[model samples]
Target: MDLSETNQTAYRHPWELSRMEILLKELEKLNIRGEVLDIGCGDGYFDKEIIKKFPLITNIWGVDIHAERCVHQGKEHYVNSYNELQKDKKSLILF
Candidate 1:
């Protein structure tokens, strides 16, 4: 399937929406306030949503094997591997 089509499907799927809702609820409970590292972040869609919902997040980064697919406001926000991301900063990691 086309990547664009897959993204459209994910947005439209009830199960996928519900899953994201649940994940967001869980994240809300944490009251996280810091950087976030999303591993295997495809297209960085969830990362965008996360930052939008949680303004306390100072920064958000995406790590994906297919780095070219990651869509972020800034290119530096996406990396090809965890090792490429700065290790010193404390961040909430999402899979």
Candidate 2:
């Protein structure tokens, strides 16, 4: 159901879930491997969703400019800046 139709507090947003689903499908088709990095990963919501659907991608990382803006609902290797991540390797970076 839509959040507007429910009396309970929203745990997930429909739009976000839809976007994740599309991304998940595309990623699955690619048969991706290695690390995944989420930039400006607010609250790590998408990270949790991705991790839940793609457990094989264990090396996931999240980076946000301000640490305070992030929420750690799931266990993620969060960093304060993109500079903290490796510059040499290609990564699946999401904005």
Candidate 3:
């Protein structure tokens, strides 16, 4: 099924769930630390779950065209563009 047809909530569809699981496993292999940049993040549901599973992650920022749809408040957690994220040059994992 096309992802565009899925529900607004992240990880609701079977494909989404499977993709997230794969991402998590890949992350485990990398043993990543520091921040994360979630491009095209919808409402940050997956970001919340990612943080829970990875204690080493200091922060997770969501960037999406539909920034208003982001549940997270403040620029610290959500931004409309990549340029906004340039303020911080910390190590980041893009997901």
How much does each candidate deviate from the true structure in C-alpha RMSD?
A: 3.1, 4.6, 3.1
Cα lDDT computed for each candidate against the true fold: 0.73, 0.65, 0.70
Model 2 TM-score is 0.69
My TM-score estimates for the predictions, one after another, are 0.77, 0.69, 0.72
Greater lDDT among 1 and 3 belongs to 1
lDDT of 1 by residue, 24-81 (tens): 9999999988998877777766777888999999988777767677744448665555
Per-residue accuracy of model 2 over 9-54 as CA lDDT, tens digit each: 3556666678878988988886656788776776666676777787
Better of 2 and 3 by lDDT: 3
RMSD of 1: 3.1
Query: Which residue pairs in candidate 2 collide?
Result: none
| Model 3 stretches with alpha carbons more than 4 Å out | 1-11, 72-81
What would the C-alpha RMSD of candidate 2 be, to one decimal place?
4.6
Q: What is the TM-score (0 to 1) of candidate 3?
A: 0.72
Instruction: Please give the distance, in angstroms, between residue 37's alpha carbon in candidate 3 and its true position after superposition.
Output: 1.1
